[model samples]
Target: MRDERSRRAAPHRQAAFDGPGAQAGRGGLSSLTRRIVVFNLVALNLLVLGVLYLGGGRDSPLTQYRERMGVEAALIGNVLEVDPAPLSPGAVAQRLEAITLSPGLELLVLAPDGAVLGRRSGDAGAQAEASRTYVLDALGGFWRVFSGVFLGDGPLPEGQDPLGQARAMMGGLQPGAPLSRIAEGATGRFVTTLMAIAPQDRVLGAVALISPLAPLDAMARARQERALRIFALATLVSTLMSLLLASTIARPLTALATAAEVGGKRDPQRPAPARVRIPDMTARSDEIGRLSGALRGMVAALYERIESNEQFAADVAHEIKNPLASLRSAVGTLRMAKRDDHRATLLEVIEHDVRRLDRLVSDISNASRLDSELVREEEEAFDLLALLRSLTGYLGGQAEKQGIDFMTDLPEGEITLRGLEPRLAQVFVNLITNAMSFCQAGDAIRVWVRRRGARVLVVVEDTGPGIPEEALQKIFARFYSHRPASEFGTHSGLGLAISKQIVEAHGGVIWAENMRATGTDPTEGPLGARFVVGLPV
Candidate 1:
């Protein structure tokens, strides 16, 4: 039966785990994995851009270059103005030779009428600074065009001296006033400042200082290239690491799901798989491990329940067959009997068999429902002493009427317990009644209760013919009856089994023992049968 059930259930279980819906869940990248990689890349790329694009402070090279150009232009104008050498080319050249100049600078001097006076070109360092590699020059050209088109960077005239353009733009100059501007030159961009040479409110000529912008552009391009290399490398490494991490997580999860599905697969030759061996991930110390452990336990419990049900069904079949056979025999014998006394005897046998069968069937029904009832019922706190008092009070009179002594030794205060009240009552009632059935006119049945540390113990002892040593263990088994033939049909033998089930359901234990006259000697004659029940306080 269990095998048939498992076989029938297998395909449905497999479909639940491996169907289209499950495939869909496994198809795309996990959201967590996507978020991990994407968010990391975004932050890293943003940081790279911020560091590259964020310009320098006031003390940057460009600001210092502008200041230096202005100071140099003013110094040149002052020198030419104070010369008193008639502003001749020879005098200006001699004066320029006497003044010190910084690297990467070109000087232009003009007469008051806008005629060229003298020119002092840049030194060797400025010439070296102007040189560029093929890659850099191409990149620079592309950048200029791109910026001009998209970033609104205006193009400078290709074949002109930027200082000359500055001079042309500033037609008139005021004394002691310097003007600075950036303009494209024949070679590259230049930062130029024009300062007027004047004395006593009289305007003379002007001196213009020019510095190349190529050095700054080259430095920026080199830094940007290095930054881009780092960004690309970082993104690649991070992406690979994120994917590896995601695989570690998802692979194990997928394996677990697959294993779970495999456990439910149907085999034509076998009832169930040898075992549903879920992967043992308990050592992982994570939620997956805990889940694996929980699943393993549940599967084990389910198999145990299945086995128990199969055994129960087999036992029920075997037990019902005996009375059914007897009933069939008695009915067949009755029709053949000619005498009335013989027919009457056959009828009595049939009635007895029918009653026994009815009792057996009723007990089996209750036993079958016991497990579900224990699970479905709710437990509440109740006083154990009060429950016992009510039982002993009602049952004691019945025992007295039957010429048997019924005694109870109950405790004083409230013995509170949390459990199904009616189920527990059924257990004690069964125990007490069984003791009563064994006892006669002179025999005594005593029920006692006591608290034992963390647990409460209840004992039902009977002073009757004690249980046989061989039958003691088997007495609690299903359909196992050891009563006298006179009371054969009165008891179904399921009472103790049901009691054991109820006790175990409440996390308690029940056991039967033969009470000996001497505690230390095993050879001593048995005095009575003792049933003990222990429950948590």
Candidate 2:
């Protein structure tokens, strides 16, 4: 009764949810998928951010502006060295005014004494004022970028324009002077060139040329913006696709977990459900699909075994009750018997019942352990011929003592087999013993082994009466027995069942059929019973 309760309680113990998901409502899909989606999104964001920072900050395309400024400064210095003495600030200004130049260039003329000569706006300076405003905006971008770092976001310069400070850094009225300025995001940039106006080998007035970088900076900024937009769009698409993949992966896994939970759930206060139907997910072409199939198969086999065990237990109880009742009846009758003959008969019946009970209990124990042994025992190659030779040599004497003829027809060469050696030996022993028990004096029992293709066959045959036609189909069922009344209580019918179990576990087959002579009459009986066991070589 305790064992029965424990067997039913096994499923309940399996369902115990001391794990974290026990308290949650629906943990299957979200639990696994959320982590995947979050990790992918974080990685995508980092990649885009890294690309943008590197593309815009230190590796911008605006370096070309500085190179052009260096060329312009060199040109001015060469021209001033030609005639410095004849070039007054006024003459140089009048000469500069007559010249056509770049639209973004501005000239700041100064005398030898470092006094401003002709600094007022003209055609070139007029063209520059608008670009100068652009430079101011670019400076604002730089200010905001580094405000928290170098500047601490302090007060802005009151009267000084950002571009004016950039120009002042180039030095005033200095000949052959070169300068460069650029801002972040390629928003604004410029270069300054200072030249001495000399007509002779004397120092004269100086001329400054300022070039605007508005057009080039604008182009670079546009290209950077376009690149960033493309990256953002690609990132968005990638995230959506990642989510789809996670859902595709998670849905089937969720179904599997849900099915397992349904099957395993058991309440101590109530019985478990009779069956749980697992959802089939084998259609998918991936590892998850294989996992689902394997789990379904494992669960199905487990339930089948459990049902078989329950049926076997019930059968054992029914079979054991007969001998137990007989034992009880004999014990009761022995106390009342008075005559010597009556006492002797009662004692003989009691001993027979005791032996029968002992045999039945022994068979049942071996039958129960067969399944576990077959699964737990390691298999190895052994010489089938050697194993058979040893067993037949040992058991031939017992057959002789019973007045039965015993012989073997095993092949001479080694017949190697891979299986549990002891278990196979047990099977052969059971079959040979069974044949010996059924044989009569002068009856020949032959044991033979032969190989065909990939399988080896072991046959044990007896010249005793063949199995009754009616019992052939049901003979391998547990506890099934059919014998003459004289042989009753002498054998427990578990031998064939245990033999079949062992054979099948080794990927082999065992079957019995009556051997008939050639050209026999239809009404004639079988010559003998033949049991053939086929095992893989």
Candidate 3:
């Protein structure tokens, strides 16, 4: 049943089904707009996310802590430099214990060999100043957080003091170099400031101040969590906006596709069905709207071409069958007719039918090839007046042989036009040839050209019998020739049709009308047939 239905409405089925698969592969016209929106939203969201996640705007609490430590270290150094009584590491440690700092800071006195002689925060006179293990014990909450198991009960890794690494990079806090550096690691964050305790221009020891980062890191983590929440919210909002954008673009596109599908749909139940109405999206001042309008127009043109091809095929079969029947009859009669005169007559008829068939076939071949030939040919700019003159000069000789005067009245200034020159020339040559066919010895043919604003008009008029009112409109149709019976086989009817095709391909217009003399007498004689071709200049 499906196959039967398809066979009945093949034209519509073929037309409507065109390009749908390709359209699907391209993900619909709206996909372009949707992808664009999604891409831009994703890009902007990533940029916002990076800024929020990476930018830590908090002031370093350790920076201020280092300032305080520097001041205390300076005091200790001054005491050692000019106290008039030399101060030892024990005296410096005692002085550092008196100079109180923030809760997470500690002061240490180290000898030149990295031996901690004294520390102010813990047991000062005991084992606190001997090694960096004391600093590791001070890692506290910041240490577990950096170790990636914030609340773990397991023992912390040994030899993981970030401050020790900083000291190593600084060559053990020796004298003669400014002693300030910040160290950060999975263990913790800290800042160290060291000053040489020089007496009598000789370095005796170094006083060190260390600030822990547990407080600052806690504040930073809190800020980051809040920033992450804001970023997530912004991303959610952007995603919603992108969906809205997709809908706005996709709605119109869906309408267009549906309209196209409907127009092309085949229904064997309904014969001679009209094309489905396409939505008019041209009112929108956007490229998508323009695309909708163009697609609608292209589909309409395709339907027209389909109908024209069907009619042309029917005409061709009908036209060819007539000559074929005549040839068959002539050959059959010639075999039976034994007399020389009758056989000669039959042979003449056969020859005439053969020539008629040849002409029709040749014209049809040219008509079929016209479209592809026009596409392959390149357009060029040539002076319109010069082309017309050249055409007249060549075809004028042919017209003179028939004793018809060929005249041209062109504008003085050359008119330049851009188009396939040879194709356009073929149009004029066909027109002139057609006019000559309908004229006699005394009848005059005139080819004149003039500019009309943005358009150039070329008129080919003949002083022969004017075309009948009924036939003027139909003359340009394929196989539509009005000639005497004597001239029937001599001229193919495709001349005017081919001419029209060429002119239209150049974005020009061609029309025919009977020329009426404009004079005092109202019933003056009709002058001739006027075929005007108008092209953009």
Candidate 4:
């Protein structure tokens, strides 16, 4: 019972494994769709990054905080410049208090060494102490935490204190340069500026404007959170849309694939299914619609061609039967003749008729079987140069017997190609035999093999009266012949037709051209023609 269950489940498991690989085999369209979707998503991400990099600072809340500090620095710098007097502690405090305003500002004057020189605020002493102390103390704590989060945690190295660093950076500024600028510090970001208080730009002291780091930090965190939320939302929407789109697109393609596989396996008598109807795409002029149209056209053409070939095969078989019967009767009559002389004459006539009948039957049979037999089989790698060498050796004696010179321009390297060897050999034989028959005394034939791009080209040139220009295109049609009755003594007119069928079967092309004799190349005499066959590698 366990074995039976496993056996039953095996097909289903195999089917599951085979499903994706089968879809992958549907050619370029499947790969093209996936590439398009991935490219779209990458482009969207890059657009977002570009927006952040260029415009992020202009919209940040930190810009407001920096402007407020700049106003205070300007006021302090003006007072020190105009008075030019040494200020006592009380006088300095009074001077700071006079300029203080509501929504309030705190002032601190620091000596160049960073010690506090004077401090003043608008409110009562205790209240002022509470606000001032809170703001001032929060500065270092904020720096510690900010440094930990953003700039990284550590004690200041010797000569590397954050405030001193700010002053040193500001010292490089030219007179009349902007007094305040934004800088990111160990704790957080700050708006720092310097003022020339002593005469002739002598450095007596500096006023530092401090703000708490929370408001700007909070705004930035919020903005980032909002951007992340938006991104998540967009991704969720895109995924849902992708699922819907993939299903919509993949379902029709899956149906088409199933139909094609079924058609391939079906017996000729079995009727095809009703045409598949894909929704939402029929009315639109898009790639999918064009694809659907092309498939329908292909199925119709295939059915017609199959029907025509079957009917033609039946007709050919029926037509050849009568000629074969006559030839058999002639042979029987010759066998019964009594005298040698009588028998000899009768046998010669019978043999001549038999040969004619045999040629006719062979041509008819080849014409009927051409299409079906020419269908592509397995493709394998083979050396064209080696194949040509073998063919030349086989046909060389025949050409010599006919009093024709046989020559070859074959290279030695292995020109690797993918094709059915037997079919290719058949095409080569037909072309060479046809050339040999027309090649006259002192005439020569040359066979050349070379590689061009991803295709291998073979050319057979013969010194014979070239085919007329008008006959070139029609030479490959069934039963086509350029030979008049004078030349029809041994010709069946089916060789070129069979050669063409074989060439087209391998997805290659063949054509003929008149070769002009130039200078001393005797092989390319005035009457010579060249037949070239090109096959993909």
Query: Candidate 4: global Cα-lDDT?
Result: 0.65
Residue-wise lDDT of candidate 2 within 343-422, one digit each (tens)? 99989998998999999999999999888888888999999999999999988889999899999998989999999999
| Model 4 pairs in collision | 143-187
User: What residue runs in model 3 are displaced by over 4 Å at the alpha carbon?
Assistant: 1-84, 88-100, 108-155, 159-171, 174-191, 199-201, 234-303, 325-350, 411-416, 519-524
Q: For candidate 3, what is the lDDT?
A: 0.73
TM-score of each: 0.66, 0.73, 0.70, 0.47
Better of 1 and 2 by TM-score: 2
Ranking by TM-score: 2, 3, 1, 4
Off by over 4 Å in 2: 1-29, 53-60, 64-217, 268-277, 332-338, 400-405, 411-416, 518-523
Candidate 4 structure quality by residue, lDDT tens digits, 394-447: 898889888899999987779887778887888899899888877788899999
Model 2 CA RMSD to the hidden true structure, in angstroms: 7.2
When 1 and 2 are scored with lDDT, the better candidate is 1
Q: Give per-candidate clash totals.
A: 0, 8, 1, 1
- Top-TM-score structure, candidate number: 2
Best-performing candidate as measured by lDDT = 1
Q: How far out, in Å, is residue 164 in model 2?
A: 6.7
Each model's C-alpha lDDT?
0.79, 0.73, 0.73, 0.65
For residues 1-537, write the lDDT of model 3, one tens digit per residue: 323533554655332323332133234436656686779677977897668545623434445556666776677666545554544567656666655555655666665566666776533232222222322344444686766675556765443463464345445544544477776656576767888866655666676777666655556555555665666677777778776776556666766776666666778888865565556666778977797678867776777676667667777887899899999999999989989999999999999999999989998999989988998988888988898889899999989988999888987978889998888888988999889989999999999887889998999999998888779778998778899877867766899999999988988899998887666463555688999999988
Pairwise TM-score winner, candidates 1 and 3: 3
Better of 1 and 3 by lDDT: 1
Candidate 2 lDDT: 0.73
